[model samples]
Target: MFRPENAQSLVGLALTLLVCWLLSENRRAFPWRLTLGAVAVQVGLVLLLFGTPGAQTVVSGVNDAVDGLAAATARGTQFVFGYMGGGDQPYQVTNAGALFVFAFQVLPLILVISALSALLWHWKILKWITQGFGLLFQRTMGLGGASALAVAVNIFLGMIESPIVIRAYLDKLTRSELFLMIVVGLATVAGSTMVAYATILKAVLPNAAAHVLVASIVSAPAGVLLARIVVPEKPGQGGYYADYGSLLKYDSAIDAISKGTMDGLTVVLNISAILIVFVAFVAIGNSLLSIFPPVLGQPVTIERILGAVFSPLAWTLGIDWKEAHEAGYLLGVKLMLTEFIAFIQLGAVPEGAMSERTRMIMTYALCGFANIGSVGITVSGMGVLMPDRRTEIIGMVWKALVAGFLATCMTASIVGAMPRELFGY
Candidate 1:
């Protein structure tokens, strides 16, 4: 079932690693053991997650839960904002698609999921899970206690939020360890935003929530692998640090909900604000470019420009050249702008613009916090906690950004190279 064409993605995989090595501070020393282990771990995750029938069922359950959560979030929105919030419309419906309002309906899911995650954290469900992953990283990948914990936490939390859990360990980490933590953070998406993204692309990509989870988990080792290559630990640098396991504390269940909702609200506002600004910029930029002649029979808008620029890279993800333009645009938007906007555009991609397989690959590739904007966000967030290392953090962000970008790229290629039957597309 492995198409010969998929081999191109393997080339992509090799090239991605090579680029990381090329950018290495210590080119003479590559962590070959760590690199091989990392790739195997990603393949293992894809197999365990998608190759089994039981795991397929789990994927279904997760999708169902996301639908239910979206429904629940809708109820809250309707109660507060009336029909505009996806409640009954007073006017005769000419177009149902018009009724699917993103601001009113989709974005609100963040608030609910955020609160639930907080509640789970208070209950120690998430904590136990994080610790389990930390143990796995420490054992399998040779990560330090705090570094492993930070990487594990990033699977479920945001860049800054994950680092906050191991705040005490931030200053204590070696250069290589700290950079790994940042790259891992950039390479993964926050659990709080996962549902919102699931809702956005559920129509285009099957079991979208599950794939998002898959992308997040697999990117961990990829991040670790790339981080180590770019900044190899000192020859004698052994990963050891204090146990920062129970650092994310809360007063009670009620306190957790309150804190979580407030945090979600911050995310919600930040998202809303960014969308407005970015969309406006896109509009302005497109308007200015309207005077330019069309290329390939399409207008020279920002989207088309982005697609043209990123097509080759998207091709590396095993997307067909014919479909690469569309995939590239989304990839470009993700790296240059934000994943949220990219998801919105991907959801709106006209049917047949790209194959379902290409869409799935893009979903995996886009499932990260690696973008120009996030580099600054991660730097600032980590800097606030350890202001003394602000300069050092700033210096390493560029390397981490490239590592994070390539980390997600590696995940896509791995998934792309596998037989569709293996994952049951």
Candidate 2:
């Protein structure tokens, strides 16, 4: 029998489609075929990983790499926060009960990981991986080579920096191509951000890095589909031309490591500031809601209100109603606010706030960069790299935002639909 949670996930999927209908600028002209194609890519990811041993072994290998990295992060966390990095067991007194210190702690890992990843790329490991994926994207989605490289690299690099891969092509990209770039940038999490998010989600999900890595990999093709639909592909578009032969002239090994470290620091600082403001906002919103009449003898908060509003959708996405409201509220917040804040809230959920299934479902759901703020970030960052095409970048922001959200939701649905056996449950 299909679990109620499975049925609920489908319901959430339907609601997401409804949201797309309501928000799309030209609803009558929406490219349903490409939208469905994006969803199909997500489904394929789940099936290949879960249904076949060969595929599972491949995914498991990737998962092991992620796990190894995450374990390193945990040890680093232990060094910084002591036992607070682990559990609340006795004989373990923690340094700071405050949240700010908690967030600041272990942030150094971002720098370490960033520097290491740059070294890996400098050695051509990540470049080959990204190019291989880019080639596959070009074949399947029929995207331009330059655009495919940018999107694939964005999966492993920050939004601002990924466009540098195709610096020569940026200034010459067409309007539709520019839109695709923005959409892909806004839809996927960069590699540096993934480590930060893993720290946040680790408290809720057992294998957070594995889930995050998978989410980004799966979202890549979805981003391609959505971008193509947002601005239908133009025929006779010139293909991408690369100057990688002289990439070392752009940066030596030491230069790449230093540059990556600086970029990661900026990202870490931005994250710190955003978390401070969002947490305060959540507290204030919840405080105001507490003035309302009690429901079931409990004062209401924004989390509960969000739960009430999004619970049905959550149920449809394969989460038990017992845990649906909390998960649903996070999804709504992720869409309306930012994925970073939603992830923080997800981590802080009180024990018993969600079931194991709900936590697993949400780990995939809240894995994108689809909030309104990212729309602006994508435009500005890409605009700087391709100043001549600023108008085209501006035009695609809204469409990219909408399409990116749908692509992430498509991922959530696919993961939710897979049989428990596939997940070894």
Candidate 3:
């Protein structure tokens, strides 16, 4: 028998594609070949990732490695920051939850992972993987050399950093290709943040490392699929820049470590500031909203407003109508704020408030960096890379954000389509 959630997800998938086409700049120019190719690639990848035995073993090993890395980070943090950072407590803990400090414990993983990512780039480990995927995308999806490379690299890098890998082709990329890069970049999380995200979700979701990794990898094609639909390429409009491999490099391992650590420090500081400022603003907004009368027996807070607006979108992702309002609130927070904030809030939700399956679906849906603030970050980053195309960048970015956001939803719907048996539920 066909599962009810799977049926819902299939419908959600169709609705997602329909919505993408409805917003297309040139619907007649839709690249059906790329569409089919991207979907096939995504399906094959997801199956290979979830169904294959050997792949599962590898994923398990990866999870173990991530745990090791997290442990190593804890060691480093404890030494630097004392017992507050997971070191031995000078006094007996009254409560386990009360003793855990997010800033001291979890945020430090960003520093360790960033430095390791830089070291891997220096060793060409990341470059080789990016090349293999880039070639696959270029051949299967008919993407330009630069677009293929950028999207593949984006699986492991940030929105702006991926473009840096294809810096040589930034100016030459067609408008469609440029937009695709941004969408894919926003659709996936960076490698540096993957472990940190896994750490956050590990308590709530088993095998969180693999889920985040698969979400980033699988969402690449979903981003491409939606981006192409929303802004289909016209023949003879842009040059075909094929893959030339990664141009990103560091002078040496030591240089990589230093640069990576500094980069991590920037992210750490930014996350701190963002959480502090955004949380306060949200509290202020909620306080202001309190003046209004309650609606439908609930206070009209920002989250409730967002939940009402996005509940339909959440429902379309195979979420139950009854639970969708809660899921919608999370999605709204993700789009309006950031995924970091979303994940934190998700971790805080009570156990029985949402099902384990719903949590998994939400995990994939909220994996990306697409949000209101990221538009400015992306445009400014892309603008710095290609100053002359700033106008085009500005024009296409908001649309790309929409595509990016929907791409993650598309990924979630596909995941929801699968039997819960595959996930050991």
Candidate number achieving the greatest lDDT relative to the actual structure: 1
After superposition, which runs of candidate 1 have C-alpha atoms over 4 Å from their true positions?
242-245
Ranking by lDDT: 1, 3, 2
- Candidate 1 residues 1-425, lDDT tens each? 87965897897799889999999999988988887888888998889878876987888888999999999999999999888898989889988888887888887888888889999988999999988988888888888888889999999977888878888777678899989989999999988898988898888788888888889999999999999999999966746664754598899999999999999999999899989998898999999999999887978899888988989998988888999988899988998889999988988887667678888898888999999989879777888998998999999999899999899999999999999877665
Candidate lDDT scores, in order, read 0.88, 0.71, 0.87
* Native-to-model Cα distance after best TM-score fit, residue 346 in candidate 1, in Å: 0.8
| Residue pairs that clash (backbone atoms under 3 angstroms), model 1 | none
Candidate 2, 139-165: lDDT as tens digits:
666667888787778788756666777
Q: Write model 3 residue lDDT over 1-425, tens digit each, in one string.
A: 35888888877788878988998998887777877787788778877877788877867887898899999998899899998887888998889888789999889999988899899989989888888888888888877777888888899878888888888777778778888998998899888888888888888887788888988898999999999899888777654565454377899999999999999998899888888888888999999999999998988899999899999989889899998999999999999999999999888887788888898899999999999878989988888889999999899888899999999999998888888877767
**Backbone clashes per model, in order?**
0, 7, 3
Give, for candidate 2, the lowest lDDT window spanning 10 residues: 241-250
lDDT of 1: 0.88
Q: Could you estimate the TM-score for every candidate?
A: 0.97, 0.83, 0.97
lDDT score for candidate 2 against the true structure: 0.71
With a 3 Å backbone cut-off (N, CA, C), the pairs that clash in candidate 3 are 145-241, 145-242, 145-243
Ranked candidates (TM-score, high to low): 1, 3, 2
Considering only N, C-alpha and C atoms within 3 Å, which residue pairs clash in candidate 2?
Answer: 5-318, 8-315, 8-316, 8-317, 9-316, 9-317, 9-318
